[model samples]
Target: MFFFMAKKDRDYFLSFIAIVFLILHLHVSANEEADRIISLPGQPKVAFQQFSGYVTVNEVAGRALFYWLTEAVQQPSSKPLVVWLNGGPGCSSVAYGASEEIGPFRISKTTSGLYLNKFSWNKLANLLFLETPAGVGFSYSNRSSDLFDTGDIRTAKDSLQFLIRWLDRFPRYKNREVYLTGESYAGHYVPQLARQIVNYNANTNHKINFKGFMVGNAVTDNYYDNLGTVNYWWSHAMISDKTYKQLMSTCDFQRQKESNECESLYYYAMDQEFGNIDQYNIYAPPCNNSDGSSATRHNMRLPHRPHSAVQLYSGYDPCTEKYAEIYYNRPDVQKALHANISGHIPYKWTACSETLNRNWNDTDSSILPIYRELIAAGLRIWVFSGDVDAVVPVTATRYSLAQLKLDTTISWYPWYVKKQVGGWTEVYKGLTFATVRGAGHEVPVFKPRAAFQLFSSFLQGKPLPKS
Candidate 1:
């Protein structure tokens, strides 16, 4: 009763998702080969190479789209190609995934630069980072007009196309076990991307290989993830009564409408204090544009841009103590202080432009059908979350997946590694959901060990690890 999404309403919600997708696909995405590759701005000590290129997807026809590819220092055993996406509906995978989360390097404290992390995920698989939906990160369109409105449709299209081109780039991995992994918004991104991959496979004779997918603290269902994140924070003492009531009284997130009082009250609450920081975290309140009048400018809540964030860490500055440690830093990160980033270490803090995000229906109802379709296709599907992550908490996923009613609960429980608890795991029918402990929206940042475990487990197509 508390989390009431009526069956009729849910059904309608889902139907809308399918219709939007059907309409978008029917339109026929523009298909011209636009420029794909872009250079890394400032050339630093070349520990590795990061290249930008386009994956020709039908959704964004005539545009190559931008994607960042990070290779491992050592060779991966023709393993799986794990594509990483950071959520924001428009977040950039390169900045968050490559720099902050599991990518090989973490920015130094003194400089807004990169330092090698001993436990980056690249050690396990070939990592591909994307600045999807065009206009994210360095990917751009000459026609500012082109940046008009971006939606999940174009995003999935770009991802599918990028996969094709990526395979072309590394033809060897053409049939490799391809796993899509991401955090927060990627919950939505990964499912859709996986669905598209399946769709592509079904449509064409040239079958593209797909192994599985992993989502960490992903935004699975808007209604639940949004509400659960807030309630979780309150239970943890992040927000006070004034703010909670403000939210209750003023905003209707589902309806996409808000009152001035609600907006004012919410910001006042945020002004109180952010919750516990996690290595992998998303902006709390699920970023409903606490920043402005329109959703267009609503997401700029970062204490500062990405570089400034890392820079603050250099001195261990603890820049925004008001927010959680993960959301903000105190005393900053240790290495970001000394990295050489003057010329071109292109720093993209917030991925995806709000201007673009607002155009399409972010709340995609098509996923249920998409999920049903994918499972029917034999593609391994797994959705995992960081328990602490309010953004895409496990609860939202649980609610969404409940509808699937798989054949049976294969085996559901917790997973552990080296005798250390990673998180809880649940398998029903064929779908699996694992909740990583002490992790936020971004699972890898807070719990690298668990993150790697989750990655490795799914990559092997084995049952998710058990406690």
Candidate 2:
């Protein structure tokens, strides 16, 4: 059996040969896969076709390693460049950005029409799709193994390395305003990466132009984000009120040690399993405890294990060909699976597989303070939320932000697109928070109109869309 180092245990001083097994392949320039600088077919809409670049860093064994992205064409002044990362701590941003979110296309739910989004965000911002952390998708390492969860520090290091090199590859945009954005657990990813940029600017003599950040349905604070969000989800009718009140009273939000086997009322309620999830036999989206039902809010619990990972990702190949290219079964993705690593290590289930169950460290020492630090340093911070997600619901986001206590008065307004009110906006303390009404965890997939308006505001560092 192959053994690997937990990120916490890795000794930087280990012998190079002992770490050689971690080098899955040596990345000599000749052997490295050059990134595809895509062209948007010179359509009347495009000023330029596309640009692409890669960030190369050394493997744990000191071998060359790389991650890259394709930047869709954009009008320099009219459009801002937005780098989007999806938070699996392992999932590829490109898979989510291109396949699901607003990068000019989307999957047809019914199969007849192409289901054009009519509100793609990239039309307003130059979209860049990144495959990060070296093992998520086309991203691979010559390194035979990776520390599971890899933690926030390593993710930040890799992302900073990626940003510095990516800027080097496309210097024309060096001065162009850049925004860091993502969804799901990216509550941490966006800020963590942003913190690095802020730190680099403060600590080093170098200057890589960075503008601001945006996070949707994110995991902000472990206690408030995880436990409080669940409670707020119930209050919003996504779950039962009784379940929430009970959880608030009995369930300790801080420790948040959830498990399926636990007999706590919290577990008993979420353990709800319908024999099948067919519409006729559906468990109604929970409402307040007053709704006629045996289930209570106390019954709602974060899924014990991540949605699909704890159950199974094996033998499941979802329909992806309908969208872009289906690379789920590719030999390259299959080869990078660290099965020998703990089951805690994740693999894609469908494309967005690493949602709930993640070995990530959600403790307090993360980028929270760094966000305040950045705000103090004059960085523009925008926190956006998708109202539909029960997990990481917007209310929980509100709870966390209220704590920041920024000096700017919160502005309640609406963002308009095509002259129609698209979403709600609040700007405070040099930070703006927007809520996409119809959207879920992945906002672009559900609310592209608001997404575009957002990037437009993001690039300009303006307030969020007016509702």
Candidate 3:
């Protein structure tokens, strides 16, 4: 062991080691910042970083899910990850959740620009909006059959895969506390995905650190949803007494198929109940140019251009959806957002794909059982409703929660935001129920400040402010 090393040779070895370490560090930094959005058309100046791209979930089918992520306003590294999904069972989360709802900006009325939402949920957490299940929005599958072959089970599985692959791409968020949140038919989506995450953690040591899930104006049970909808319509005087009576006497919501007599009465009742109004928010004025067509077009469909646009109460514009469509479909905007690069999709992007909606294959009768299981598993579950939403009204959610029969931890009480009564809230042993006053089915789009308040509380696992 008496070898003498030359000084130049030793120095050369040390320098090589330093260069190698520096290159490795740079590589990690580059990967961390991959897919960063340098700028977007009509976007205002902001300090937080934004990202958008696709994560392939299935290779054989060339299936991918698209996501738009906004880091927290200040210290993004310390914030939790919150993923938002919009439910039509076929709607676009990027269109609704990112553009029109709680995302950082709202599409401007002019259809050529955007404006910052002062109450964006990204202020509190890293917000991720996903266009899921391979057929909605910019997400697509190479196998054409994959478009129509989707349901709760397939959706959950693919979403889980998306999360896994997405984290691989941006590993910084791999260990962060994750919250799965959605609304409407996401009543089915959020719970199912959480269950899958739980199973995933149990089998492998790879934990996603899933904290909980929250849904607003969700569809938990068809029977209660239908019953409560009729009751809400009748109580609110949206339907005639005879129509309400007929709906109650003839319809059996629990059954998969209804009798001919029931269908006739149901259709008649719906005709009177909806008419030319926006069923999403019963009291809110209908979009002027909208013909108020079928349930698929009015209640579940994404906003699109009509012959003309109308103004709603306050600064809210009913034509925002049209603006969103115009803004996103721009060739330059797609390049900026890094969308449609793979050519898996054949046509231009739309807010909600009619093809996807028509092809959607699964409709579960109830997601209530999943709720019971998740609550028993000690997951933080919060379900909020926009009181004015006739489609999935507060009454409907109330009836569905009643089926759970969880012991009440806090009695019903008013919750406040900015010194005003925001809504009502109740706490159960493992779940919480809340309502957003004057909000619609898409609560954030109608009452953003209140929705932000609700969302901040949910992420912090804190009760809504009671005053």
Candidate 4:
């Protein structure tokens, strides 16, 4: 067909084709430069590209959310996109999720360097960590009042907007299979965000390729969570018989508000149960220098205090949180991450924002109803618990699932990783529940290999290994 064309016309068509190709090439090149992370301070050499910056969700308010993305270790273009959130209701996914748990690197023991995290989730997916709600981590809002005016509904709306803008910035991920995963309060964040995405898809021309979501040690139903906490403490023999009796007799789990006597007894029981230990992982040692002043702060679930290199079970570092705080605050480090570029952020970065936690509003008593809706929509849902986490224990999660009354498709059984039992799992009609053995509130930080295996199975939509 080309040979049949007149010589001048054929040359003209060839030139047009060349021009189109050049334009396409330049488009990709521009995107690469715009999102490229030059380098991170003290970062180890790596094969994958990383990017960090703000995606403005509201231009008028100067509201932006911070994100750090690590492309998959291999064939990133073909892999799924996994967004991870950490649940303090005010936690920084960058500080907790990225630095200490599942990102490509962890703060070195020396506190001044970085080291490779062999079990980084990006090995199998393009992992994204978001610091959301406008006041956590490096995310910020220009309006001072906006920092304190955040809640579950507002956070979800802002997060949906952040995702839409983020996709515009990194358009390559627009069509990828998207999965939401988070721990603790993220139990609330993940479901709410998923619901918003579903609603957006239903109403708008632009669509998100939403697949499924996974949560660990999540706060789902306050009634079950509180009840389970008491039961867990009693079962673990952490509380006295009298305290247990008081909890059972005086505290009404079903009540929206408990009596003064019940509140007193509950606090007493918690004090007896936790003492000076790290409540997130009962068996793990508390940060040596911690004075226990933050013990009553539930939102500060995984507080890290600097300590000596005394190894604990699973080689978990009790001081990783402190190390992350120091690393993130370094001027050069912030510059490398493209964080706090405006110099207008009022506070230094912390793993969890105390102000945000105090000001949080519009919390739903239970997210179980949202779960039910998502399940019926046929989205693959998996709920996991770190068995050693007392903050939101496995017992609480189990009780919450029981309330849903989803019939078991597969009976409870041990799941394996590396020829060893990593956890126990059960498949229900609409969800899968699993427990990670010997893990704490942050499963990946406490049991990296098992956590990675669980993540791999979830992304593949396969049941955990039985052998």
Candidate 5:
């Protein structure tokens, strides 16, 4: 089947191929341009470029995941790309991660304005906040069943698809060094997504530059998490000794099904014993009404209670998520961010989807196996905990990491920030573990300076400051 072609004919064929590539390049550039954000509603002027849009992951299901990318403020081209997810199994990264924790802006009280976050993570790397699982925040699937059909596997698969298509839309970042980070239940999402990216890289010729991943106050192993959580409550004096002993005996962490006794005892610990304090931050005040009942809780769900949207405190708005809900639902805000253009959404925007949370199908009992795989692959991994968070406290993280049986590379020591003890750290052979002093479940929201320092250290592949 071999035939010799004339030089002129070969030259023409090569030129035709080059032209096709050029046309495709232009089309991708146009798509990127369409997603560029000139400015958000009530946003202050900033130097970095921003883009927010949706990348369809499944055409048959009409599923698309929403993303908001904030490039590094200085030397944007040289910085690595960091994908930040917030874990509720059904939470919106845009509302929690972007607006409240690490993204560039904080929603103002009026919910119609924005203010800069001095400790935004974008200062060091490009931050991409994603709303995943097709029903969180602005992401959606036309097939209603898709909303109900979500779990670790589908979420990881859809997120991997989103990254592949997103890289095409912004080709410059296709080969950029990337890191995955998140908090709360994202302990599952971050590791699962990282595993997906690793698998994708193994099979594809074009590999993603995924260096490593880090998680804070993560839910690792069910048995360890439950054990450590009970211990933390008792040790912190949040629960009575009587309740702690009952939890240890009644709750079967190994079983997927919970007995009525365990369920009631768990509720008793949170409601009757723990008082009206913020479980996410034990020392911080709850988002409360005038009647002194709690209005909202983060990540963790409690018994149904009624409360108004009124803020009882002066500073550090605990109702920040409320502001995000108002801001993102505005017509002008959606138009500015290029969201909800199709008018396909039949319901109002919410920070977390209650239906999806209730119906989530499968969850791995432990992610320690995935951790071992990534560590063996020589990818940098880190786990951190906020000491004050009762929901998933430092004790829980320590218990989970212990199951890995990793050899300790560095003895435990206090890490410093600005001449103060920021946290304690221990470097394992394959992973690093650290704690933020007096910080809560949302580390950055409570201890931004220390969180920023820890982030900078992670990106640089260096240990936290020893002095």
Candidate 6:
């Protein structure tokens, strides 16, 4: 067919093709600019820029993941690009990581405004908060079945696609040093995605300069996590010794399906014996108004902080998620964020998705193998815990990491922030473990300054200050 064309006609057709390509390129560039957020409602004046929108991960599936990128506060081009995910296996990074934890702005109590977080991670790096798995938060899919069928593998694959396609939108970040950070179930997410990037970079021209990952209060090994969790409850005096013995004897932590005896004792320990204290933070007061449903959700792995204010962290607002829900659900807020443009969400914005949580299909019982693989790959892996969190407690993290049997480079010692003992830390041959002294499951929320210091050290590849 090509050989049949006249010379002049071939040149004309080639010119037309070039013109169409230019138009398409301009259209995409325009869409990128369209996603820029001039300012969120009630947002304080800031020098840095913000952008939020959806990146379609699976065109055939109509699955698009929402991302909010907060550029670094100073010399953005020179800063690294840090990607953050919050773990519910089905959670909104926007609600928790962005609005509450590490993002630049915190939603005010009135839900009418925002304020600066002095410890925003973006102060040092270009922070990208992603709401993943297609059904969490503002991220959505036109295909209904995609929501019901979610798992670690699919989530990681989609996130890799998101990062790849997202780079097409913001090409400046293509070669930037990237680090994956998350907490809780992201213990699975951070490492899994890092593994995906490692494989992808090996096989393809499209590479993500993924340096390492850091997860706080993360769920690593089911066996070790459950074992350590039971011990933490007993040692912390949260549950009766009898219940602890029952758990240890009846439950096989490696078994995905527990025996009836194990299930019963587990519920009893959490429901009856653990009492009304906030499981996320043992010493902190529970939200009086919360029905306490979150504590029992998906084996108590969900964030248990609820819709009531608490005085920790200098007025650490437990209700920040609530405020986030309110603010993001507003039509104005959605429009500004360039979210839900298709009007296909069919639900209010939430910090976490109960449907995805319940139906999550394939969870790797342990992520430790991936940790080993990535560690050998020489990724800068750091695992930290908020000591007070009973759910996925520090003991659980310690137990899980000990299974690695890595050589210790530094003995355990207190790491200080402003002359106060912030937490304890130990450096292994390839990984670092640290604890936030009084923090809960959400370290940045409970100890922002310390969390920031920890993040700074991670990026700089420096030891935590010993003085």
User: TM-score: which candidate is best?
Assistant: 5
Q: Write the per-residue lDDT of candidate 1 for residues 76-140, one digit (tens) a residue.
A: 65546788876665555655677667877554544334456666777777788876766665455
- The digit string of per-residue lDDT tens for model 3 on 1-467 reads 11365888778878999999899778766765667888898889999999988888989988889899999999999999999998776778878888878899888877667789888899999999989888888898889988777878889999999998788777789899999999887888899999998889878877888989999988888788878877998998888988888878988878645678877775665565567766777676665545644222333211111111212456677766677778888877888888997666678787776666666676668888888878888899999999887778899899999999989989999999999999999999999999999988888878888999999899889999997
* Cα distance off (Å), candidate 1, residue 364: 1.2
RMSD of 1: 15.4
Rate residue 441 of model 3 by lDDT.
85
lDDT per residue as tens, model 6, 222-310: 88988888889999998887887878887888876677877788778777887766677778765444665432232543222122222
Candidate 1 is scored at a TM of: 0.70
Badly placed stretches (over 4 Å) of model 4 are 1-32, 254-259, 290-314
Q: What C-alpha lDDT does candidate 6 achieve relative to the native structure?
A: 0.86
Q: Which stretches of candidate 6 lie over 4 Å from their true place?
A: 1-28, 290-314
Measured against the true structure, the TM-scores of the candidates, in listed sequence, are 0.70, 0.71, 0.91, 0.90, 0.94, 0.91
Against the correct fold, how does model 6 do in TM-score? 0.91
Ranking by lDDT: 5, 6, 4, 3, 1, 2
Question: Considering summed lDDT, which 10 consecutive residues are worst modelled in model 5?
Answer: 302-311
Candidate 3: which stretches are off by over 4 Å?
Answer: 1-34, 290-296, 299-312
Global Cα lDDT for candidate 5:
0.86
Clashes of each: 41, 19, 0, 0, 0, 0
Which model, 2 or 4, shows the larger lDDT?
4
lDDT for 334 (candidate 5): 94
RMSD of 6: 4.4
lDDT score for residue 235 of model 4? 88
Top candidate by lDDT:
5
- Can you write out model 4's per-residue Cα lDDT over 1-467, one digit (the tens) per residue? 99999999999999999999899878866765665788788888898989888888989998899998999999999999999988777888988889878899988878778989989999999999999889988999998888687889989999999998888778788899999999888988999999999999999888999999999998888789878977887888778888888888887776645778887786676665557666677787755656644322332221111111111364566667778789999999888888998896768888888778767766777889999999988899999999887778899899988989999998999999999999999999989999999888888878889999999999999999998
